[model samples]
Target chain A: MTGREPIIDIRNVSMRFDDTLVLDDISLSIANGEFLTFLGPSGCGKTTLLRLLAGFESPTSGDIFINGQRMNDVPPHRREVNTVFQSYALFPHMTVFENVAFGLRRKKLPASEIKGRVAEMLALVKLEGLGGRRPAQLSGGQQQRVALARAVVNRPLVLLLDEPLSALDFKLRTQMQMELKHLQRRLGITFVFVTHDQAEAFAMSDRVAVMSSGHITQRGTPQEIYENPQNLFVASFVGEINILDAVITGHAPDHLEATIEGRRGALHSRRDYPDGQRVKVLLRPEDLRLSRPEDPEAAEACFSGVIKECTYKGATVDIQVEIEGGKALQATEFFNEDSEDIDYRPGEPVRVSWVRGWETVLPDD
Target chain B: MIRIVKAAYVSLVYAFLYVPILVLVVFAFNDSRVATNWQGFSLRWFAKLFGNETLLGAAVNSVLVGVLAATLATAIGTLAAVAIYRYRFLGRKVLSTAVYILTIQPDIVMGISLLVLFMAVRMPLGFTTLLLAHVTFCIPFVTITVLGRLKGFDTHIVEAAQDLGASEYEIFLRIILPMILPAVAAGWLLSFTLSLDDVMVSFFVTGPSFEILPLKIYAMVKLGVKPEVNALSAILLVLTFCIVFAAQLMMKERREK
Candidate 1:
């Protein structure tokens, strides 16, 4: 995955469906043998981008390159890319073995070789001894495995997956996610996956690109995206966060001081910010800490609040605190059987605080 | 009492529909020359039907027209249905609506309109005109049946085929054609029966030279009731029932699969 040339380069691709812009000028590069995921909500153009790469659709503008060759005019059959469609799209009339062998037969391979390869692929997907069964007879998860085997049997240079697990149950989906990641590593093929589930993308991808309204708002590793999102949409879409409207009051070479509705707080940012600029301060739910009035470490940026709601989630108890200026901040505290901490009721008063560098400031939208 | 009344009503409906055909079939084997009296059971009328030169010639012409018109109609209708269902272009809605309209219009009106079309083009009302009219009307039936099958098709299956390195031509020959084959055969069978049983339309376009079986039966029936005509009608009924039965079987297999 490291120090390898990108196998698929999508350069400035834009797709318009009649009057609606489905994919804005999007550029992305997929490294060889790496699994990259396009994560977004429905109608966010992730599927459209995948289709453009698979040659199922031609972009309204720009070009695509695969293996250092321009593929603007390559038809889907001529391109060395295969897609596992969302519906599985296995020919209903064909058995599992026949479906897996379709591509091999299309290449005019000998009958004996086709049979061997198909049997090997079926075994790889752990669907051995089920070759004679048709798609209709298999369960949804089994059908999905067959679809994967069929596409992988073709030995495509890139495998494109368009929400192939969206149809499975949650438990099956989670199981398949691990299996798919393991298979991708073992096969060492470049995979471009499109999905709307952030947790699934984080679990399976080497890199994740978060898209919103036909544009990618952020692209990075899972940790970077979670800790450092570039925009408000990406921050909220990836996880839960509390956004505070703030104005920069003073600034120095390395840091800046900001006020949230007359409350003083010091903010640190790697990027430069001009003085008096308006911005939104972001705080993750787990980052905010709850304390009592007698705590000595409850220093600057502490807000006196009353607990409004508390929900125990087995592993952690989530408490929503209503602080000054009528703003609510949610804080999560993990359970510790060994510690001698007291749990507070709904109407108890408390203080909400975080460290100095815990906040992220972004330009107000 | 209510159950008995319900049974009586159902029996009455069945008898009303089947009695005339049953009489026609049974009287074909009547030895008497007159159909009003059944003197005995025999195969004399069937023998007379086979020996009649004029009726046999009409039967041959009808078979020729039915086979030719059915093949041509199925080919054109399958292509038209694929275009109407798969692609979006200018006037697509109107074209499909026109096909629907052709199916529902009265047969007399279509026969008259086709007669006018042939007359305006100065085409002689003979084999060519009859064949042309049959193909035109049969196309809509074939298209409608095929379109019904196409309604449930998942186009992504074709895309998946292309993804597996099947070219456009190969995909059509291997995937699309095989998937829709049952419906296509049903359409062809339906067209054949429609052409074979046609009388009103054939009466308008079929000239004196290219006599067909249906018109010959009509001409004979106009004279009087004859046992020979009964045998011919019985044979024609069996032929039509066989064709329609085959079509239903094809459609049933498609549904079950």
Candidate 2:
């Protein structure tokens, strides 16, 4: 999907529903054959943006271009984009085969072609023998597959999925996430998936756009978003991370020093900030390492804190260490049989340390 | 003892509701022309009912008006329900609420209002006026019925149709109509029955030249309650049962499958 020309370009689109603004100046350029996700909390405008792009709605301001053609006035029926709705939205009266063949029939395709295409789509979605069944007869996952087949059978230029997997159980959701990603790759159609699940978005999207309060807070690859959240909301919303109020005590061209309570830690920032600037620093739980206070390698900035709580997660143990100023910092460590620190109990004193570059300095807002 | 008492009470309520109808049905089979006494069981009254030219003509007229009024009302009302469901415009709330008001309003009031309107417009008191009045009342019933089905109806399915290259017409034809057909049919059946059973509105608008079964029965009852009316009422009751039973079966099939 790399180096492909832009397919759907949404420029400064804003949507307002009566008195409330649903989407605020959302601008995005989707590359052809790329799978992008709009990841956000509920009422954060991700679904609204997807609706706008699918031509279910026209923007209150700005324009949307599909294949570089203005699609502002194009109705959903005339647009080349199709949607896999959150509810699956399969026509209850139609059989699975009929549902998938609906778009082809609308195009006035020959009967044989419509049959062949519907059959092929059913096969693709692994619903080959169940075409005679109505949507109500199928399970949730099967209905979802029918919906996907129905949307993709038309070979739409862009497939917009609005939280399509939200209705499935956890196990089914995980399984369908991989299948949907695989299908998108196989089809190579530009897909814009909207979801509130960060894990699902991270697992499938090539680039995830994080939205909050009707604004795109950040748009980047999953790793970039997880490791380098630009704002406090993105940092907290994307995944669990420790946010600490720190005062910038020293400023340098490429580095800065922040003091939390009486302890100072060095951080590498792209831009220099003035001294005494109040900012928040985000530290991932996985990035924090715990060691004994008397261990030989107590180098760099290490904080001494009493363990407030320790929880044994399946793969890793989450330990909350209370540092100075009564602030609790969470640190996670994977379980190892040979590891001596696995038995770290509550109220035990420990030293927490992290490398300089692992910390993300975020804007206060 | 309590269980027996409860059962007795339930039976009493059922008897209270059905005894009159049961008596009417039993008398309809009586051999005598007078309805007061039970004569030997025979189908003479049913034969007379079929033999009566005026009553048979009115019955035919009632069927014609029922079919026409129900069809027209269902068409207009289903479209109104869809429009009220999908689009937001001025007076949408008032229009939808008006359906409920119309349904709950007294039949005489609606009939009198229509009569006044027809009189004011100088529309002749005849089949056209009667049919129009029937359709006007039936529209609210159809709207309310279809609206009940549309309560949990997924708007996303409509959007999905449009997204899949279906125009508004195609979406309604292929998706919306089929999805709500059961409700529409239920509405149409209800409207048909209401039109068939109607007397007040038909009495207000129908001229002597154009008569419906209910008004004719009302006139006959004024003259005297006869075995023929009993047989006709029993037949009408059976027809209503068949239609309602069929509707229930359809609904059950949809639920089960």
Candidate 3:
């Protein structure tokens, strides 16, 4: 609760495999009972970071304190953290009840207490009646739940998930994501989940760290990351962002005027950047609007372009307008009677307008 | 027509390989005094052989030595295979080379060399030497058979066992060993047959005190070919065939499971 105390602290941790640096110096912490996710593409060292926290590997030069205990040489079994791998890794020869009871058995608990706790944990994961069956007999999701129950029965301080839902189908993964999040909240256990799916991380974690090339590029709440990204990598990686090269013409307090191609326009962002700097403006498709350039109420710097691509997606229509000088502007028209007015076929010229008051301008191009 | 000719050629090759053994068995059962004549069948020679104690003692000795040699070879070979498969350290190549020599060396050379080495060490040459010779040759065969199975062994299962909190010893005892049991048993049975049939090594290693069934049969054949040896050969053939057949059955069961 104090500013100086964090439940988990990682400082300047780096992992080098031979000559290649697998994980660069990374420092971060999680407060008590925080659901944190390390999200990135494959081989981005997110899994390596998770393994470091679980005491599977010692950092090259850094300190990891778990609940105020320095855990440099501690083995994974001796640590207060447990990891659920993507394979589920339930013992094939043991029954569900025995598998769930294994860790406690290793701790040398009494038989009566072990039996009681095994049943309780299995029921907590909704696997009570299936105790007699082996892991091979269970479905993918069921086995995953058994793995979760097995790890949690020991009451580890932290639960580490290494792409636990990567093996599930889309619908099953979403269902399990919700279930896992709820289970973590109910148990009041800090869950550090590692995955590469943006939607899964956003849907499950209280905070997500987007890692790239062995370093965290950005870390924030799902809303903060989606609404405000610090760089082009973050903007493009976190969500769907359409980036356009623009040279700054003038700088204002709230917005920047820039020349995009031969067209001159103004782009709005809460973050201020220097004028006449070559920057890329990130525009989401939903922010662009389609209108006729002849409209008197339209904003300044309107140019006409032929529709390059169009796709109908449920309630909205996505139209890509290729402006003069081959600039593609992606615009979405809301489906309704209003869509009829904005309806334009591919190769038809129409004015593609974007709201400069919401687009993000990037610097250090 | 060419396919039919190929099929006929395959059949001819099989007949060439097996028909002589069939002929030997048939003549052994015939009551003819000569090699080609057919007379009434009788169990007179087999009955007389059962009354003789020396051939029976040699047969019993062969069975005992075969069991001991196979068991020892299997245990040592299984441990060596597991150790080499699980860990890598120095002297592995040298040890592996020694084992390769044991397997690939000619039987007569190995027999003569072991005889010289045993004599140089002032070792007793009897059942002990015979058993030692059989076990040495069988060890390499057992190791090779089990090592092939170990090469395909799934290490993930061991890691999975550890992740579920099983200790290192328990993983080996419960998971890895059980998964390779069929191969180990096959190796043991193979060693048993090889020890039973070893003539060259047994000839160099045996003494006047201990006699194996194969050496006794050879001695009998050189003295005067007996219908008794024919009867015993038929029985030994059946026993060896049964062991090989049982091993194949066990292998098939493992695959099915």
Per-residue lDDT of model 2, residues A1-365, tens digit only: 54589998989989999999998888889999999999999999988888888887889998999999999999999999899999998888889989999999999999999999899989988998999999989999999999999999999999999999999999999999999999999999999999999999999999999999889999999999999888888889987999888788986666787786568877777656678887787899999988777776555545888999989889899999998678899988988888766679888878888866788876454
- Give the per-residue Cα lDDT of candidate 3 at A140: 92
lDDT of 3 by residue, B81-186 (tens): 8877776789887876788788878899989999998999999999888999999999988888788877774554454455545576776786668767888999
lDDT of each: 0.90, 0.89, 0.83
**How are the candidates ranked when ordered by lDDT, highest leading?**
1, 2, 3
Screening candidate 2 with a backbone cut-off below 3 angstroms (N, C-alpha, C), the clashing residue pairs are none
DockQ of 1: 0.70
DockQ list for all candidates: 0.70, 0.86, 0.33
CAPRI verdict (incorrect, acceptable, medium, high) for model 3: acceptable
Alpha-carbon lDDT of model 2? 0.89
Instruction: Report how far residue B193 has shifted in candidate 1, in Å.
Output: 1.8
Runs with alpha carbons beyond 4 Å of true place in candidate 3: A1-5, A291-304, A315-320, A327-344, A355-357, B1-10, B24-28, B32-52, B91-120, B140-154, B200-209, B214-230, B249-257
User: B45-164, model 1: which lDDT tens digit per residue?
Assistant: 999999999999999999999999999999999989988886789999999999999998999999999999999999989999999999999999999989988887887898999999
Candidates 1 and 2, the one with greater lDDT: 1
Chain A vs native chain A, TM-score per candidate: 0.95, 0.96, 0.92
lDDT of 2 at A3: 54
Q: Ten residues in a row with the worst lDDT in model 1 chain B?
A: B168-177
Clashes of 2: 0
Query: Each model's TM-score?
Result: 0.90, 0.96, 0.86
